[model samples]
Target: MTTHLIDKIAWIHLADGRVLSTRSHGRDRYYLPGGKREAGESDLDTLVREAKEELTVDLDPFTATFLGEFRAQADAHPDGIEVRMRCYESAYQGRIQASAEIAEVVWLTYADRHLTSPVDQIIFDHLHDQGRL
Candidate 1:
């Protein structure tokens, strides 16, 4: 099977025991705030760029902390490819707003696992194992 490296960052805003998530345009499932890295871009750069494009918010790279790496199949794609998602936690400025790429924003609790994307499900699993859920 072919594998693709997808560097992703999760902006975990834990407030009132919930996590913030976003739905991209034309995508049904909700995901943690993040995107893939462009060529020659660092992991932090990708997170910052994706957050700006999708959420219309600026992420403080300095405040960004590396969480952990996740590997999963790209279930949303036609080809059965694998993806490596590099997760992170960070602080940002401005209210959450959906931009051209994003359709909606929501805060989900750990109990709402069914609403997340396949990859996000794995993330939730890890978070739960770590007692962060």
Candidate 2:
């Protein structure tokens, strides 16, 4: 069997014990605020752009900190398809609201893990175990 990998970047913002999550237009599962890197774009470039496009916030690149990378079966994809998510935590400017392809923005606690994609569930677990969520 062949295994395919999808590379993605994500922002992990925690506040008041809840992590930020977004549901894209017409999608049921919520995911962290970030997306795939464009050609020749660094992780910071992708993080800043995706944050603005999806959450209407300006992430302070100088304040961005690497969290960890996680991998799991891609949600709604074939059995051998997986997603590798590189996550970061950062400070940002402006209030968060659904923008661009995002349909909704919500703060999720550990108990809400079931509503997220497989990779996000792993992220939630990590945050929970660290007592951050």
Candidate 3:
């Protein structure tokens, strides 16, 4: 059996009970504004780079804090492929505009849960129950 394991990092940027999400080009579902780490990069490095590349924001490393980690079957991947998502709560600068492969950026609330991936749904549930989503 082949194991498809993906290690990814994500950001949970919240404001007024909504979370920031991005829709990549040619993708229907919305995801948090981060991605897989490059070789030899720390979580913080990946966070900074992905945020800029995808959302044109510069994440403030000093204000970063771990939120939670989640895992689920990878969407759009073959069976047996799983994704481990490590998330963080952090502050950022610069006006957030879609960059790179990102096509749109939106703020989502609990009512918008179905638009996200399985792992992101878990985050939405947690944040909603905590009065944040």
Q: Top lDDT: which candidate number?
A: 2
In candidate 3, stretches whose alpha carbon ends up further than 4 angstroms from where it belongs are none
TM-score of 3: 0.95
- Model 3 lDDT on a 0 to 1 scale: 0.90
lDDT of 1 by residue, 1-133 (tens): 5565555556665577677898887878898888777789898888889888888889999998887888776658655666677888888888789887788999888899888877788888887787777
- Model 3 has how many clashing residue pairs? 0
TM-score of each: 0.88, 0.97, 0.95
| lDDT pick, better of 1 and 2 | 2
How does candidate 2 score on lDDT?
A: 0.94
Please identify model 2 stretches exceeding 4 Å from their true place.
none
lDDT of 3 at 55: 88
- Candidate 1 regions exceeding 4 Å error are none
Worst 10 residues of 2 by lDDT: 95-104
Better lDDT candidate (1, 3): 3
What TM-score would candidate 2 get against the native?
0.97
